[model samples]
Target: MSQYKPENPATEEEEPDTLLMQLRRKEGSWLDWAQACQTLLQRQKMTPQVIFEATGFEPIHQNQIVVGSQVYEGMAKAGASPAVLEYFGRKGSDILYELRILSPKDRVQVAELILNRNLNADDAHEIARAVKNYAQLRERPEGFGDHPGDAVAYQAWKTAQQTSDLQERTRAIGRAFQYVHSDGARQQIERLLSTVAASSSGGSQRKILPKLSVFRLEEDLPRLLPVVGSLPLSTAAWEQQITPEPEGPYHLIHSQGQQTWVALPAWSVIQSARDPVAIPIENRLLGTLLNQQIPPEEAQDPVLLVVDRAVRQWQSEGFFLIDRAGSLEVEWREDSGSVSLFGRVLMAVRPPRILDEVVAQDPWQLDE
Candidate 1:
């Protein structure tokens, strides 16, 4: 057995010795263990590895409990019901750990949902992801309300909207109905399911948009003419090479003589682009700006910047491509200045890498 003592024992009330005794004996509930581990780490300035070596608690377990305990505390602070609190106090550390991804208020709502539905760790994970993704959307879908159930239903509904298969759409709608709490939302989902069932019964097929496709800049051949020389090229030069086709589906254009293309969903902004172009981005600072938008696998690789030359009016919230002394760069500016405005950035695209696919296929293989 490893014997460990705190370097600077503060007050007797802290009871560092008592906490250590409890941990050593493996006494108390999981919540109590978590609280003790957190206190030891935060108040005693003890390293997790040291605590692990002494208490037989793995460092990864320590991390989960510490974070889970904090989330439980947040739930308590958010006015979680007594039954919900009591249920989590003894068990559900993994469920609480997943709730850490949500806000305090969201955590409470999700916790109650978990308790009511008797959901396990995997269900908690799915609910947390659904709620987080729904919260990030700029505009909430019409039928969905601001409830945990509504978030999950909205996710299912969105999936149903993007697929053309009747059976798949019906399954998605049924899933939405399973989680939907509000009567209005349930009714909407039922209507959608009915339509899908009717379509499956040899009725007029419901019209649904094609599933959103990921267009790789490297894989998809470029459609638009390439641009040369410094950016913010004269109006005549841009007009000569690129023409506005508002009715057309293709929008991606590439520079640097590279035949790269990115197909975007029918976004109004991309559709209305008079002069669209795609440029390879190498700036680290720009990458930092777009870090949230880029996937982790493609973080180190150069991203494709798709921009529309038609919209150049400066806005505080908008990012624009500019001609900075013969060099082209992307910047977020508060006000327009002498810097030439090349175009407004529509989106930053990360091309799929073959290396990622190769590694994913045989991740455990050793080098010969």
Candidate 2:
């Protein structure tokens, strides 16, 4: 018999965690897809004044500084560009954010993400009439990403458009246990199963680990992450509407009256949500998601004390997801940019980094 088992039972490679990780990362921004669309469209209809008002930044006039090629000090540079490095000799606040937003890279990212992943051709140009309706929605020059043949799905779809049948490409993707799953992934699965089995030993299972899950049993014991409430008003098709305006990038205070928008940092915003107590507040989002993976009533509490002050966003450039496995936790990657417009909800899935910090030093605190 061979000494090594498969990485994953499905395929015998290193492991499939990387792929799953990538997929998770991609989907991380999906919840915000609707909002991104909103952002792009609003740009056109929104005047410079509106932009200033919405983002709270005043425009600056000419005579910019040039300390170095990369550095610009003193007065602003020439021309009435859409953005100014400094306004009337005073470096404007939030201009740094706008520069990044207006960068070609940002446009490319949004374009690829939306066209490649977010929109379907019909929703895109799939239905001619649907295309007309979508056309009514403004798409800005800043948008990049999708061309006619850019997306893989779009590639296959366009072929299907010209061809008679598509039983081939869809069939190709079905190569399951034969081509997927790596060796390391299988070992991890084995270790997890063993651990779950060990945990299943009733009272003997250590409380520090909670009860482990063996496929279905794990979901039953709670501790899997919850998804709380969802914002989609309807489970229907092709209708657009906006409600709930933007608030400041405040710390999403679970406390009352504190609900008003405040000029808080991104780190503060993320950190506040990490608080286990905030779970009840976040139950709408996290709880709903968790309920799908694990049962709602049965899930164990995280027993974490979220650190309010020490909390911070990563360079004001990212988001995190916390994947709970009863006791064991997993952190997922996300790329949520900084910019907390009012009224919009900052959706969180998993954030083990923030959660880990909060969970340290036994939160139970001996019945004070």
Candidate 3:
């Protein structure tokens, strides 16, 4: 056996930390370096206003700002602000990037919270883990970031926040119910109803009561009657009869004589502008036919037959393609905008060249 030699990897052509150190020592310009840090923060969706506030870099010089690769690394290494550094760290690493649900405000809030040492990095992550919904539920309330509160309480409160006006009202009903356990339950309930009543006008009162009825608080129904008029009976009894039907492979609507209406399973449509495979065969055929790849008469039938067979097989086996690794195009919805969605359930087997081309091009585009 050969004697083992420890591997010593060569340094990268551009080491961001080294370059930042060099700039710091030689240039002696904190503003220039601060601007660099600002650019990096902006890329991570940190607002320019926040960065300027965090680091008091005077915006006096017009030509002071210049673009460079190492701004992020420089900013991160310099410890400009703990919040900024944590944001940089969360974004820079692959592990923390999964918190895509957290909006820019949520991120800034977390950064600010971190600055105050009210929230640890782990607590910040818990906030980010909540799924982004139609309701801007991730947004912190006015006084939330001001104090470092329990992570669980903050998460619950954020969840309770709804974006839609009607949903917000509905949520308030739920909160009023929850507040019953707390010390100031009666005050909270009165405040909630008062706010709803203040917002309600003559005609809109009809609409508001009906929507509020959607979220049933059986215990509070007696108290709510005077405010909301009369409560409708909860639909729980009838909902069982209309339990959701299963989605089968196919559905038949008509079976009479010649005329019939049958629906196939809704196949996912992928918008793959960059995929060569997605290019229409008719468009490609002209060039191929001109090059004499195939006779014009025979080209269409063989291609159509191959596609038909492949589709049939794919549907039958629940796989568009299969190999030693796993199946492809089986369970994935091509319409999904998520990049990590594929990696979540299965390993996507793609051609090495295609992967290389994807990696080499604009990196952000892949996420899209």
What TM-score do all the candidates reach, one by one?
A: 0.55, 0.13, 0.21
Q: Which has the greatest lDDT? A: 1
Poorly placed runs, candidate 2 (over 4 Å) = 1-284, 287-292, 299-308, 315-333, 340-368
C-alpha lDDT (0 to 100) for residue 128 of candidate 2: 27
lDDT of 3 by residue, 10-126 (tens): 122434444334334534343334334433344344444544444453332111232211333344333457656545433322212323344444444444444454445465455
lDDT of each: 0.73, 0.28, 0.33
Q: Top TM-score: which candidate number?
A: 1
**Residues forming the 10-long window of minimal summed lDDT in candidate 3:** 222-231
Ranking, lDDT, top scorer first: 1, 3, 2
Instruction: Supply candidate 3's per-residue lDDT for 363.
Output: 73
lDDT of 2 by residue, 192-271 (tens): 33443454454243233334667432211211112221332221210121112223342122433323222222443443
Which scores higher on lDDT, 1 or 2? 1
What's the lDDT of the predicted structure labeled candidate 1?
0.73
Q: After superposition, how far is residue 321 of candidate 3 from its true place, in Å?
A: 37
- Name the better of 2 and 3 by lDDT: 3
